[model samples]
Each structure stands twice: as structure tokens, then as C-alpha cells.
Target: MHKSIAIIYNQPAASPYRDRNEQSAEDGVLVEVAAVEKALHFLGYLTSKIPLALPLEQAFSELSLITADIVFNLFEGFSGFPETEALIVEQLEALKLRYTGSPAAALKLALDKAETKTVLKQEGILTPAFQLLDNATLSDFKLNFPCIVKPNAEDASHSLNVKSVVYDYDALKDMVSEISGMYGKKALVEEYIDGREFNMTIMGNNILTTLPISEICFSLPQDT
Candidate 1:
């Protein structure tokens, strides 16, 4: 039951590098912002929309002038700048603004696949061994054959499909190259975790509230 300034993010509209062969898609939607704004409106928040596709200084400067009482921080990114997700949250904190959901540091750790792995290791969570393959770093990496390749910072199965599995040196090179080039992000290739995947949702702040555990299943594998 309070007014707030909400920051929201979604992929900016862009035509895929047009080729005569590329068909179009229905324009994407900003579901997160829409749903949050709807809920806040019901709760008496005078919500104002902030469409960000530029630098943080622009948002920060404008927020400095806005009269919103609290910030409902939903900004997942600032347009083309995905790395600045947590940085913007830090800006909000420095500006003495309160927002919703997880903090900036948590967002950054989860957003980055590599850093998350390091933290998992620190917490004694068993994870597949991983190697970061930039143009310069992987010379000594002794990856076993039949490794999996994917873009480092990408989530949502982007650039990951049947072809993402590699069985030889050349296959690894090609998969890494394709993911890095096409996704515009670093590639994170690791030993494929050949196990059942589980989805769990953790809710509530102080008290523990959990939804029933969910299992993720896939079609049976084909013999190579």
C-alpha cells in the first residue's frame, strides 16, 4: 500500500540481422513489468514506467529528480547492457532507495554462470568441472571427449541444443566458436551433468515456504 518507482527490463526491440531468408516473429512482451505494475496498482502505488535502453547515468539522474516514494526494482537490465544489472541496483542502494525481491549482489551472482559455480564450490555443492574458454584462457584445459558447450552468461537454453554436445577437438572448437559468436556472450562448456534435473521454488522471506518439488523430464536419448 505505498507509491514507488519501479525499474523494469526486457529485450529491446531489434530486427534480427535481416537476411532475405529470415522470417519475422511476433514482437516480444514485457511480462514482468506488466504483472508487477498491475499488482502495485491494486496496492495503491502510483506506478511510473521507465523504459531503459541506455546508460545507467541516465536512469540514475532521472530517478534523482523523480518524486516516487520507494523503488520497485525490477530492472533486469538496461537495454543492451546486461552486465549492469547489479550495478544499477547498487546505484539504487547508494541513492537510498528501497525496492523489491533479491538484492543486487544476488542478481549478479545468479546472472553470471561462472561466478555462481565458484560460489557453489565454496558452499560444497557438487558441480561438473568447468572451463572458461576465451580466446586466451583455455590453452591448458584438458577437457575429456564428449563435453558439452554453451555460452557462459546465457540462460534459457540459448545456443544450446543437440548440436551443443561435442565429441572431439574440432567439434569442441566449432561449438565454442558458434556459441560465442552468435550469443554475443562468453561461452561456458562443462562436462554434461547426466542426471535427472529437479525444479524447486523457494518462497517467503523469514519463514520457509516451498512449493512441491517439480521434475524436469526429456525424451529418451537416441544411440549415437
Candidate 2:
């Protein structure tokens, strides 16, 4: 059976690197979409490519088009919305269409760093001390200084940068305000780990395996 696939990626407004020309304009997301499209075309999948400014509806109802088979989930975000990842999956499930990548709950859990940390902490895992914010109170309790501030509900380093490190109360307050205003979400401030850095990647549930652990290499005059 032939299938229609939608290769979606992060949109501009939701991207923190929207203005970052580290490589080129357009944030290079189109490059990703194009790569995936080309790869599938190389394969034997009768795929139809589509750009998503909306959710799963993007796969259908565009110039009178609708997909009847599998939908290769490539959507990173929709219409500059940061939390739209799971939303797309949900729409797919509602349509009873098979796609790829993490399920909706995983997307929700991974996107919410605070919840993920709590689950980890409850499981006796180590995590940095953190705080959540809202319109009312934001860190009334003591939070470790020289901390890192990240959006409570955003990813892709939205407003996160090396400058996200703040050492004083006023700086923290300003950062929180800016983040809340810009992303319609709270900020999480956690103690900065000054010693070392590392990363771990896990693929497939109930079938866990570590390929190669990543390490941070501190160069002279960089870590200091």
C-alpha cells in the first residue's frame, strides 16, 4: 500500500535560533526536512511531503488532500508553537494513523523538564535543586545562586544561553520576567554544576541500550 508522509520540523517563531546565523538563514530546518524527504524518496516509500503550520490536520485538508496510509512523524513543532510536538501526535492518534518517534506521553514528559526531574527524583535519581514560577510567587524560597535558568515548558534553548547564568536576585527576577513574557511560561532556576558536564541518550522503551556516552571537553580559558 502506498503512504503519505509529512516531514515537519521546528517553525521560526518557536525557535530560539531564529535569528542565529551560525550556519545560514531559515535556521536550516528546511535542510532537515529536505534531507528526510530525499532519504525516503531514495527508499521505496511512496511518500508525499508537506509543511505543517498546523497540527496533524496538515496531513489532510490542504488544497483538498488527505492521507490514507502511514504518516511518518517528522513534525518538530507547528506554527511557531513550542509545545506542539505531542499535540501533533495526539491528532495522529485521534485519526488512528501510525507514525514515528516518541509517543505523545513521552513527548509531554520530555518537554516538561520539571515533571521529568520530579519523576527522576522520586525514583532516587540525582537532580539539581530547582524552582517553578507563576504569576504569583516565583522562588520565594531560597534558590542556589549562580544558577541556570531555563524555560519551564520550552526546549531548543528558547531563551537559554551561557548568559542564562545569573548570580543575583535582580538578574533572576528579570530573566524570569522576560521568559514568562516571551514564552507564556515559567522559568526554572537550578544550581549550576560547575565541575563537569555529560549527556546520555536512550533509544526504544523496554529495550534500553547505551551506545556511546558523550563527554564535555573543557578547553583552556573556556571552562575557567
Candidate 3:
């Protein structure tokens, strides 16, 4: 007997981007979904592709109707509404369905960068000193010059661009206000750490396995 898989992913919509020329990260998920579905089919598993959209109740109803043994869990939530990503996972839990990827708790924690930083600090991990600005008021700004500002709750580099890095207080204030006005979220200001960045992908639950590490080589300016 073959195992059935439900490849659930977000149906992307037009969203605001700091760089208009940059492709929509939300829409990019479709390409990933297609690849995963193809691989599953090639491996002889019965796969069903379900694209979810806005209105959480409708998405939940659609999920509730799934009969697959497991879900691929590619849903990243609707554009301009990143909070729905974890909410969808919570619904999956309520349905008592096994799904791939991180749990709702982890998703919620990761979405809030400030909270994640706090957790890291508690765990004795060394992270850069940072502050969250809910508005344009920048009294007692302590972060050094050449700091970077970004939307507090966004992922996929939504409001991040070349201009995200600031070298002065005026530019920092402007950037913070830009994030608040455009994304309607608090701004996170952190001291700029100029150095190499790498990403490590880990898999599994009880016994984790780390994949090959990849380094991000920057060809852009230092402040970018």
C-alpha cells in the first residue's frame, strides 16, 4: 500500500515589497510546492496539492477535509498576514494531523525576532545588542552608527533593502518610521556586525542531522 501525501502551500497574493523589482517571495512558494509534489510522485506516493488562501476559516475547512496520511506543510500564510502561518499550524494540531516542518509554538517564537533574541540571551547565546522601536520617537537611542533596521515581525526580508542599513541617527529614524508606516510593525534596530554569514540546515525530531553548511558571500557594499 502506498502512503498518501497532501502538499499544502499558500496561494500567494500581491504584496508590498521594499524593492519593486525583487520577485515576490510568497509566490516563490508555488515553485517549491511543485518541486516537492513532483518528487513525491516520483517516489510512488499518492500526492494531492492543496493551495490555501485568505479567510482562515475557509483554509481550516479545507484542511479538515484532508484524508492524506501526512501533510507537506508548505503553507506560509497569506501576504501581508504572516501571523496566519502559525495559526494554520495550530489548526492542524486541532485536527490531530501529522505534518512536516516546525510546530506552531516554534513558528510563533521565530516570527517575533525580538522575542527570539530574548530567548537566545536567556540560553546564554551571544546575540547583538538590539532595541525595538514601536514608533518614530528615538529617545535614548544607544545602538552604534551603521546599524540596521528592519520590520520586527516579518520574514523573507520583506522590508529589507540596500537602504535598510543606516550610518546616522537621522537615517535610522527615517528607516524606523519607514518600517512602521509601510509594514505597520515595530522596527528592530541592531548594531551592525560586518562579517561572514552562513546557514546550517538541520533535520529530524528526536535525532537531528545537520546538512552541509552554506556561506552567504556578499558582493554588495558593506552597509547592504
Best by TM-score: 3
Using alpha carbons, what is the TM-score of model 2?
A: 0.76
TM-score winner, 2 or 3: 3
Instruction: State the TM-score for model 1.
Output: 0.74
Per-residue C-alpha lDDT of model 1 across residues 1-224, encoded as one tens digit per residue: 55565554533545332231221211233676788788878877788876655556776776566467777665555433456778777777787776666778887788789889999999999888888785455565587767899777644444567878888877887787777777666678787767788999886678878899999877776873
| Model 2, span 160-188: residue lDDT tens | 66668889988888777776776677777
List model 3 lDDT by residue over 61-127, tens digit each. 9999999999999998777788999999999999999999999999999999999999999999999
Candidate ordering by TM-score (highest first): 3, 2, 1
CA lDDT of each prediction against the hidden true structure? 0.68, 0.69, 0.87
Best by lDDT: 3
Supply the global lDDT for candidate 3: 0.87
Root-mean-square deviation per candidate: 5.0, 4.4, 2.9
Provide the clash count, candidate 3.
Answer: 0
| lDDT assessment of candidate 1 | 0.68
Q: Which stretches in model 3 have alpha-carbon errors above 4 Å?
A: 18-23, 220-224
Q: Write down the RMSD of candidate 2 (Cα, Å).
A: 4.4
